[model samples]
Target: MRRRFWLLLPLLSLAGALQAQAPLDLPQQAASAQPAEAADYQVLDFDWQDKSRQREVPVRLYWPAQAASAAVPLVVFSHGLGGSRQGYSYLGRYWASQGYASLHVQHVGSDRRIWTGNVFSLIGRLQDAAKESEALDRVRDMRFALDRLLAAEQGAHIDRQRIVAAGHSYGATTSLLLAGARPPDAPAGLQDERIRAAIIISAPPFYGQGAPEPILAPVRVPTLHVTATEDVINVPGYHSEAGDRLSVFEATGGQRKRLAVFTGGSHSIFTDRAGTGGVTLNPQVKAATRELTLAFLSSVFEGREEGLQSWHQRWKPLLARWQ
Candidate 1:
């Protein structure tokens, strides 16, 4: 039980924190404005089976409706704990409209299913999802998805050189692993060399891990860290402050890394859900996040810092720190 307690602490804390937020009325929003925006891009759903592990990896791809003359860059996204592929459509749609293919991978073990069933069993489910096995499986899911996607017909339209790994919360930790973060207990060769950069948003510390520096020191790829001054996770006996995101940024091993800290927003604001932060500030932060990600991608891939600079200047009022 003690071993299980340690393993479950981080994810359980995250689950509890997110549960504290009001549920998003996504169904109503989907019926109203989501379809209008859907016209700008094509959303493709796939249920991929990794035969080796017998796990189902569900993904939603937001592809540009009008194909670009040149191969488009790809962003493979992983969702946070209790989130599905459908959770971050805003970012996917925005990226797709801008000529980037965003592939959102849903890790079954840690998905929304955990929120179902008897309330008494919730803790057990959370524990299962937080296990190291599930964490490693999330990484393999991304790797396998990439292999399959690159071999598919759409692969010809993707720019292999500009592939990026991105995620929020628990998913951000997964992105870090792909970007070369090596937790003390993590096995070797988890890094995916194909991912040239990473976008880590609201990433929590690897709880129970001694320190982030050694774990993140191996991450050599360019990275963009996004968080809010109020991006904190609170649950019984566990508390992760917004500064944890900065510690991660500081420890990450890359000269090209950038950090963006919004003035005020909750950790869940980055998800598709709305109203958990501030009614007005929620949308503003989302828009800024979308723009910041695009700017970061441009800086890393096109060698253009102008977009980053412009974004910083434009969103300066809402930002607590931009570095």
Candidate 2:
């Protein structure tokens, strides 16, 4: 069992490198909607040290320049494997502009540093990043970052009850673990009760694990799953179909869950990369994704489903499924 798990690590860690080979035939829009500019929010960088684990957790916090009278909502984001704190600036800026604090946590062990060094050793690095130890450390990085954030001066402005966990690909797996996923032989105390909702983008399955239902049944938080029909992960010996995302959504235990499947896009389209998916559709999907996240947040925090309905109406043409 351990050997089989080791063999699947490459497929798990390299999920962000999904190739977008699907042909996009959607009607062209006159112009893609742009996210708010960086000037709208205040960006703060932090390099925190976890003395116990001897790990470095780097993070970027995007706070709204225009403060609200009451505490503001917060979204803690985890990036995909091989991504960094700066990878998803679009979502951070947008969320901050709309009165929510966005905290992006970077896990060093599985981050972009693995892409450096000898090209011949790339596979080895990916395997190491996907090891169970590093995966657990990613979760610890998030929890530790949250603790540090809440203790900081700006933490006073954050609305603790409105906190959400979000991520893409491998990071999505992290989000699920925080949302209460229980893999076999995993340790206890993985879930953080502070996360009221979650936004999972292009989530990969728990490889070498038996059935997804048992593994994902503990994720009871309100979840919004975002994926595309072409979000396929193709490694040398393993392949993860876009349908896996749907299966996860189905198995995830939540009565208030929602899913939005774009017609055609690569898994990497959600990242900062603008060209992995169709150039015309990439920005469109990103814009829609950010807006969808905000709508999901509104529904979770403010109990407002109107924004979600409105978003569905506006972006229906780009969607293969929404529910």
Candidate 3:
């Protein structure tokens, strides 16, 4: 009987743990989101690379008009899962206007345009192994594009030393990996060089079982982490987990890093578009996200340090919903 009781004890505890309540006030909690803007940047669209004439990824470069003379700092941006390079134009264009060169890449096979399969399958793209390959490919794409843009023929005026790699969600994962977050070896060819800084927005977890803490610990450059309070698809508590892990690099006293959490903001809020699953809500969330993103990019890329300092101060109060 004691043996039976002991066996049942573990099951009972497991059941209780499984049955534990998840927090309910997600929407209410997410009522806080903020963004600010300054000016408009020049938009340039061009073909980056192609396997064939028919299959080529298009790139959009946003360059601040004011930076035509000076060599502006550069930011290479990747979009979220099921998103195109154009998806986050709101951020790309704004960052360019702030005296930075923003390069937005359209990932082949993984973009929202090619993702017309099952809904579950589409969701799976967020953490798929193939997406990892695409991530590395994106880094390569950035390297290749940098060569073209900086060359005398392409007419680009960008600062090579201040290049930053950034993305949203799975795109954010790509940014981390490019900044030296290595995954288990795949058939992909990803070079671990060239990135000076990183900005990861609501990235999903790539490291599974036995993956070390601070999976992206090798990132020696400055990093900024941005996430919403209610990012359900990206998983619970992930923003904090990533922030904590990346902070190790900061604590060891090497790189400059910061994590900003917005209340009442949803996963899609970080995106330029307002809706994903046919639900439209929270314009405030989107606005705040873009504003902060611009300020961060400007500070890191364009040497606009004062704009970065005034960011949280000017936007914090607006983030609190019903306050």
lDDT of 1 by residue, 1-323 (tens): 32221243433324322223232333223222122354777889999999999999999999987654679899999988888999888899989988899999999999999999999998788878878888899999999999889898788889999999999988899999999998878888899999999999988776667777888999999999999888887765667778888998999998899999987778888887765566666766787788889999999999999999988777787788988
> Across residues 167-273, which tens digit of lDDT does each residue of candidate 3 receive?
87667766776776644543334534667888877665544413434445556677777764454442322222334323323332125676666554455556764
Best by TM-score: 2
**Superior candidate under TM-score, 2 versus 3:** 2
Error of 1 at 222 (Å): 0.5
Per-residue error for 63 in candidate 2, Å, reads 0.8
- What are the C-alpha RMSDs, in order, of all predicted structures? 4.7, 2.8, 10.0
Clashes of 3: 7
lDDT of 2 by residue, 79-179 (tens): 98888999788899889989899999999998989889999999888788877888888899999999999999888888889889999888888999999
Predictions ranked by lDDT, top down?
A: 2, 1, 3
Query: How much is 201 displaced in model 2, in angstroms?
Result: 0.2
Worst 10 contiguous positions by lDDT, candidate 2: 3-12
List runs of model 3 lying over 4 Å from the truth: 1-40, 50-55, 117-132, 152-156, 186-192, 212-214, 234-254, 275-281, 297-306, 318-323
Give per-residue lDDT, candidate 1, residue 315.
Answer: 74
How close to the true structure is residue 203 of candidate 3, measured as C-alpha lDDT? 62
Model 2 misses residue 130 by how many Å? 0.8
